[model samples]
Target: MLLAAAVCPHPPLLVPALTGAQDGPPTGPAAEAATAAADLRATCLAAVRDLLATAGPDADVVVVGTGPTPGSAAPDAVGSLSGYGADVTLGLARVTDVPPTGLPSLPLSITIGLWLLREAGYDGPARARVVTQHATPAECADLGARLAAFPALTVLLVMGDGSARRDEKAPGALDERALPFDTAAAEALADADTAALAALDPDLAHDLLATGRAPWQILAGAVEADGRPWKSELRSSDAPYGVGYLVAVWTPA
Candidate 1:
């Protein structure tokens, strides 16, 4: 069976209560919005998962959904990503939207959140189906709870900058709210060489602590910026293993 978790920004996806008479379609706005949304989802998901693989190796990799509507299974869709030993789904709902007097409604931020998940090699399928159905907080929470209870569930990786408290203990869960990306680790990678990072990739090492919940390996590769190699040696301050960061280097044999 597949274990899943739910993570969303507080509040929730806000659809304008009042459908006002609007001007003509904002083509430029729509196009720009779509592009920006895609980029953000990709980047944020990557950063988050990258940090996780480096820091939280025991976590079961997952897919971060995008858009207001949760994802549903498709007949043509390939089953699960058995390679990583985990499954994931994502929704583009703005669960973190604050009201008029609350925090700014940044629906686009979901893009970043989803992106971070992808960057870390967490290419899982989407099981969420609320993005199109307009899910309520209770409904979303209920689904999340079920996922957390899943036997294979190990962690509920939430994005945004907030917190979540899952009551059940069967599948120990974790909620990593809006934490800053580990820029120091990236910088360290920039300064380190591949020789020192071989073990950083899970495939190269077998001693990573395992809780038997979501056990997987991280494959390390050399750093590259703009198609060029970004080389450096990762040090203690830069790469804190078993914390919330992992830094590894890889080279062609």
Candidate 2:
């Protein structure tokens, strides 16, 4: 059963290296965004560390993220940010003698998970799984149930962004509906409301461009399958750079 879970956003900029040169201190809007990103990154790392602790030493971890298709990687799987113009490379495990299997590169969400594990110096066994953004709610729930059935103590690290159209300058442009959707999502996560998360409409989520919809629904499934009391704490919630980024931690009550 899942002992702990953490949710984080997967913006490439979360990595300092991807934030461009630090030749000089940023000013104006850039400075504000940089500060916000830095804080979010720190919070995300802390939440992951807390998750690891909740799972206990050497616990097995399952990292979930959204992608174009469903795929999985072993603990030693390596991912690179070169596509994002950074040469930084990260792996799911702290040390791996295993070489690449010539599989396709990890999607953005899993890559971010890899970075988080490395940053937290997590030395436990962990693997990454990506669910397609278009996956149906039922499919997500099924996957979550399977994950919850892992024999050993398992912790889930879910990575995805809420919405990209929270403001006029947002990536998807400002949408009046975006805020309400994100607000509901944040509330559900904070309350550990599995029903609310499970009931999230795929159509509405797609319309709002909420990348976290499928993954969050998967989490709801896992919680339900585990059939244990849990509580959630909202660590951070904000629309930085017009994208809704929320961080939350859930542990058994």
Task: State every prediction's TM-score relative to the real structure.
Answer: 0.28, 0.93
| Local accuracy of candidate 1 as per-residue lDDT tens digits, 1-253 | 1222223221111111111113333365465534433333333344345445543444443332323435442312222211222322233232223311222222232332343444445544322222222233233434544443445424333332111111122122332220122232233334543223222322111122111101101011202111234332322111111123222222221
Summarize candidate 2's per-residue lDDT along 104-192 as a digit string, tens digits.
Answer: 36788988987887788785556888888889999989998988998888899999898899988898898888999999999999999
lDDT score of residue 137 within candidate 1: 29
Name the runs in model 2 displaced over 4 angstroms: 21-24, 74-76, 93-104
> What lDDT is obtained when candidate 1 is compared to the true structure?
0.29
**Candidate 1 least-lDDT 10 residues:** 210-219
Q: How badly does each model clash, as a count of residue pairs? A: 51, 1
What Cα-based lDDT does every candidate model obtain? 0.29, 0.85
Pick the lDDT winner.
2
